[model samples]
Target: MSDFTQQPQNQHGSHQPYPGPYGGAPAPQPQPVRNGLGTAALVLGVIGALAGVIPLLFWVAGVLGVLALILGLSGRGRAKRGEAANKGVATAGAVLGLVAMILSVVGAVIVFKAASDVVEEVDKALDSASTAPKDPSTAESGAPAAEETPDGKPLAAGDASVYDDDLQVSVSAPKPVEAGEYAIGHTEGNKVYEVSIVVENGGKKAFASDSLAVSARAGAEGATAEEIFDGDTYGKGFTGTVLPGKKATVKYAFDAPADAKTLTVEVTPGFDYNPTQWELTL
Candidate 1:
């Protein structure tokens, strides 16, 4: 009978028979596999997200993170191919990438808001300082030159003497007054009025005791009053001295009438300042 179990032998004088069901030769072995792409995507995504290096490029990193996450969710099917990477890393990358994208948008908004505030503040300062004598020539000659805007336009009521960048005072008008509007800088409705001034020490350094005093006049003839540096003025009034970086918010109101046509506000916002003082008119 034909020998079913006995297969042909090797020709090189070997004892092993040809590979077959009965030949006893080693069975064919599958090739080793790897999941290198998934691991790499996860790592790149995580690094991008944490570093915030390319916030504007979130789409790229986020996409990578998602792709890695998908592969990881597959139960590490390719790990059997020999790429001994972890599945958790892919998920973390996805989470971080998404977070980075959201934070980037928030950060952008904050930056824009800060920039706009600074610009508005500077404009107000320039406008208020408009009346300031610019031509050392004319000012020395005692001729009242026309006020100019930052870019040299006719000064507007929005003019302010204090710039937020140079100084930031959280002023409280004791009585409700427009903080930064046309009606600001005056107590009277028509612009003529007495305005009590108060500057709050809202920074991180010692400011001079006189830094909080402010004065206002109606058409150069309005009544003016200072927050008395009395015992009652501490902490919340002009009376107390500001400590290094401590707060000294002053509160006081002035007589603002509805019939006046013009008013001017003045103050010195710093410790070393006894600056000719700043003025804003409305």
Candidate 2:
């Protein structure tokens, strides 16, 4: 018998030694797969949706929602193909993204509407004040003035006047006050004139304070006058909300040339095109 004897070879009775079954090297392990896009989409969608309620953040919310939608769809596709996890979360994210986008659009529309309303109010105020003669010179330009109506009679100091829907107005005569202890002096070669006015709102709506304006013209038979105060500034003119069926008294100070003779004071109630003028002899 040889030192290395063959194992039992029964069937073929071959003289070759029987070799054990050959085995190859162990196979490489697969890398652990990870997909986080689904979670990312879900988080962004939720945050964007919440932010949509804020007026200032609505625009940002819209952008984030769109991004979430894209990512969520991609994540959902991956989940369906078994390439990623969190399929339910991805679906929820997509839905939330759509809702956030819609809400954002609605919010933007509301903001624009509010802004439009404000602009309209401003327009109305401006229209109310448009009755003033643009070129104070028009009254003295050698052109014939409009025939003054009873309600539109020119006012002077201390005249009881009524105009535009029964609004009662009165102004004290313009008195010259030299800059002294009780008064501030007018600019060089100018005279300070003070007028006290009482306005009664007979209309149904509350008076818009912004609609009040005062303009002065040269009192001379042919001289022109320009606006000295528009009631735009506080303290110097009338300002504040006047409720319906209310009355307010305001004092006005005007500076004019010392020689301005015939002074006309025009009072305008807010939002009405027609204005009432009072003629006063200095």
Candidate 3:
């Protein structure tokens, strides 16, 4: 018999090799599920939704929302095809992106409407100011000449001062009056005079009589005259409203130096009106 070596053999009688300690060629590792797109979509959707509530950020939110929606849809398709994991995450990202886009549109609309309204109101106010009449006395130059009466002279008693609005104010000639022994605002050496002031509202709107003001100066020295209060016939000033085409009259007493020959009275209809003066012989 020829010399022979024993070897492991297969059932078919062919030589066979022994298996290695390490497992058969390591089973190909399953490729890591590609979920990057899904994750990115979710992140962008969350950011877009957060910004959507702010009206000023509507543009940013709209852009992010569109990107999220596109990426999420692609990711979901990949998940369906077994290319990516996190199918639920991809779907939620798409829904959130849609919500963010809707909010952005609403916010943008509100912002636009508010801006338009503000612009319109500003335009109306400008128009009204431009069309309103201006008073020469209140002009930029502020010249004393602009404040002079139309006739360039102080009005005489019983003369009416007509305003730009057609309202008229007049004062009656001063008449001597006796002060009650106990009356208020009387100076021992002063003479008392009573005068009537009349305000006529010729404009379409009612005139506010309460806003009327009257003051007087006595003699060439220009001393301020004191107003007298005698319960019976003096001290009541202008009051109530004067309707269109109506008149309001009030009587007032002033105390002046006994030798005063003239009383210069000034009348103002309202805060907006220019003061007008009258010269009254006392």
Candidate 4:
């Protein structure tokens, strides 16, 4: 009788160790919950919040705020789901993102309102320009209309040149005179003439006669005639002021070439009045 104590033998079976407590491959370490989304959300939220205060950057702030809000919410959800470990950080990021969004909305409103006001002002200015009356003296070419005068001819002696609808200036016909032997501005071969300038003031304001000016040209060559100052016979320009409704007159002498056929005299009432001309046959 063979000993029947035969060890349990299996067909090509290898001996396996008995499982022990805490032996299974040391439960795979859960990868550290990546907090990348939460960190990114925090950073973006901070930037967006800072940009939200500037009016010109309102649009940029709005775009960044939207992105931050979406990212923050996503990160918060990830944290809540236990996919990320930074739950507090994610919540803070979401709060900041919400604040940034609110500020961006306010900034956008301010920017839009300012732009609207500027546009309205521009429109009003354009309307005013369009409705304003055109100046009657301005021609279609934007130049002042030509003034009608005595056919571009100088006024005759004794004819008044009206100014400001109140003042009248007239020049008398030239009277030939013999120059004194030692007269100041007379050439030996030239002739001298005396003329009178009369100014009638019809307006309420006194005319400043001290600023009056007189000049003369001789012959067809338009040579400047020399003024002759001979004792008290000829005075220098005008003096003082002409009272309203009064008349002022001054006599002047001019020396011209011996054979000059004509004399042209110009009278300026004052610095304010345009100079008027008178033509005289010599």
TM-score of 2: 0.45
Error of 3 at 276 (Å): 0.3
User: Over the stretch 1-282, how does candidate 1's per-residue lDDT look in tens digits?
Assistant: 876676555787566845565756698986544545456646655664654445455455445545545555442544544444554554554555455556556555666777899999998667556423232122212222223445333223322232322233322222323322332233334322223433433335555665444654544556553222223322243554666435444444334445434444455554434332223344
Comparing 2 and 4 on TM-score, the stronger one:
4
**Model 1's TM-score against the true structure:** 0.32
**Pairs clashing in candidate 4?**
none
Candidate 3 regions with alpha-carbon error over 4 angstroms: 1-151
Q: Rank by lDDT, highest first.
A: 3, 4, 2, 1
- Once superposed on the true structure, which residue ranges of model 1 sit more than 4 Å away at CA? 1-32, 53-85, 131-282
- lDDT, candidate 2, equals 0.66
lDDT against true structure, model 3 = 0.81
Residue 185 local lDDT, model 4? 90
Tell me the TM-score of each prediction against the true structure: 0.32, 0.45, 0.55, 0.47
lDDT of candidates 1 onward, in order: 0.44, 0.66, 0.81, 0.77
Worst 10 residues of 4 by lDDT: 131-140
Candidate 1 yields a Cα-based lDDT of: 0.44
Ranking by TM-score: 3, 4, 2, 1
Q: Decide which is better by lDDT, 1 or 2.
A: 2
